[model samples]
Target: MAENGALLRVENLVKSFDGLRAVNNCTLEVRKGCLTGLIGPNGAGKTTLFNLITGFLKPTSGRIHFNGERIDGLPPHLTFRKGIVRTFQVPRELKSMTVLENLMLVPSDQAGERIWNPWLFGFRVSRQERQIYDKALQILEFVDLQHLRDEYASSLSSGQKKLLELARTLMCDPQLILLDEPGAGVNPALMKRLVERLELLCHELGITFFVIEHDMDLITRLCNPVIVMSNGEVIAEGSPEEIKGDERVLEAYLGGQYLAGT
Candidate 1:
């Protein structure tokens, strides 16, 4: 809905911590339905930028627009309601809850959540809860977590937890998902499944993804028109092959080894 066909856009955005500028006059866009990659070295402000976009951190200046509406400085819950959702690098699962329960908790304002409604409108509340439960089961099946629906989140492996995180986001029916270091701590076998699921979500389900990852191989395989950030600024935007051959990108992050492989 944004002008120029960008689903989300940041203009001259800045975030400062004391005297340090973590994100300095940065700007970018995530086109609708694209699997966009954001790659940068440590201290390059990639996470800081995500924090700003998701309303976890307030920007000091500039503007953020989602679907053609200004959303800078909105609270995290407000952003979530606007169909922008984000996942942490380390999955934030409720360890004591069952996988199904974890997914069920994501949708806001269920009729059964109100005490009076549950007591006065018992039939309505029961029906609403059944609907939510059915949707949670379908999402678990999509992410291959249906088999663990009754298992406590604490019992799952690191990779499964990551999958659980993705399943939880689906409950919100988000328009765009910001994934931070999704490949981190995931084994190669699990990583392949994750990639396939992400692809299906983007292509088949019309969900857009903006991902930050350190794994070049994963970025190369999954993303198009990759965005490179260095010192809190985007220096290049290109295809996987173009990014690999870029001299500035090589010097700033990718380096000679990446070029050699290319």
Candidate 2:
């Protein structure tokens, strides 16, 4: 049953590509202000499910509701405007742009981009740019990337790029963030910082997160009521402890290992 205060709801969702089901008959609800985890082995349709919910791929059937309103068939940008945003496994920063410039570009409301802005509104654009700059710097400091603010995004380390992506997402003032393997390829030292920042975002900013991760340690530490998928459908959902001990989950992970390496 969908909770009354649920922030996201999916009912009997289905998606197919070339007559092959990528996500099959899925139904779930993400409660308001909760950190939820979606986990599975490789090719488990985890990313496919995320793409469906975020509007990267349209569902073949079923319904999606966000904040009690139907949002199926909406484009990705419209979904983003509705306070839903997603991060990629690899950070998508402009290599040539400075870190601050990258963050400054995340917010979509740009007055100067309009054709009439230059002639009709000179100082307004300047004021808005200054305000955006200030906010971008504040976000940089928040992510502990202030020292690298002026550096080319390409020059930063992989972990720093991930942080920059998170900073850019924050610029949108999102209500829900769908994270795709946030800790993947990050170093241990910076990975800790990433975890801390996510926790703070949930606790302080009241943002909801639905994360897809392979790192069981990260999932155990940060997520609750974890949802597991395999073969294009949800297999199980429970707390970290329960999931760890689940026979089906063990089979999903260890069964192949036993056959391949034994």
Candidate 3:
């Protein structure tokens, strides 16, 4: 297990595509129970770093530490089994599945998963399914989507789909959640709701979040100790307030006018 108190840590992490380094010798730590933010301009390699950490892409060099063990090149499913889960910029749901079923499908190693077990051990499988269903209902209500539990995932609005996605992640009881962009297409009202739910999850449930976001306003309002990446490398790390005024950050992405206005 990862010692000290960092839930996730990357040291000298690097990735390259056709000799073009996308994440170059980057190093960062996400402490346990933190709602940390990662933000940068387009092509800043933020997503690539997320990919590396989540095992979507293996690092060309360096190590990734999660909960004190080296999880550098583990497959995505294995990484998830180890309690590091990631959601994409675009929510991916089983469109034909009900919201409740979608949530039920995330917790791996379910007794109902084995093709033979469900048949030979029907009662056991049924009991397990009931447990998963009950858990799914609770998660749906936690994310305020219980009313839509029976609705097809495709029927949900974009914001509701985002909520569904967040609900599904809770099924695994992950230690760290890598959110690509929770506020990407959400409207102000829904974004506020999402932020509030996440804050409650962080402070109350103590779920750790390592987020990648572009909305500076959302970042400033919701995050602390934001990490900024530029040109495939981390350029700065500090509080949201400090980042808003940093000359380098303003020059790289947020222009002086925008910084001044904020």
Q: How do the residues 170-220 of candidate 1 rate in per-residue lDDT, one tens digit apiece?
A: 998999999998888888898999999999999999999999988899898
- Specify the highest-TM-score model's number: 1
Task: List candidate 1 segments past 4 Å from native.
Answer: 258-262
**Candidate 3 wrong stretches, greater than 4 Å:** 1-4, 257-260
Candidate 2 ranges with C-alpha deviation above 4 Å: 256-262
Q: How far is each candidate from the true structure, as Cα RMSD in Å?
A: 1.4, 2.8, 1.5
Lowest lDDT 10-residue stretch of candidate 1? 253-262
- lDDT of residue 12 for candidate 1: 97
C-alpha displacement of 117 in model 1, angstroms?
1.2
Range of the 10 consecutive residues with the lowest summed lDDT in candidate 2: 253-262
lDDT of 2 at 178: 93
TM for candidate 1 is: 0.96
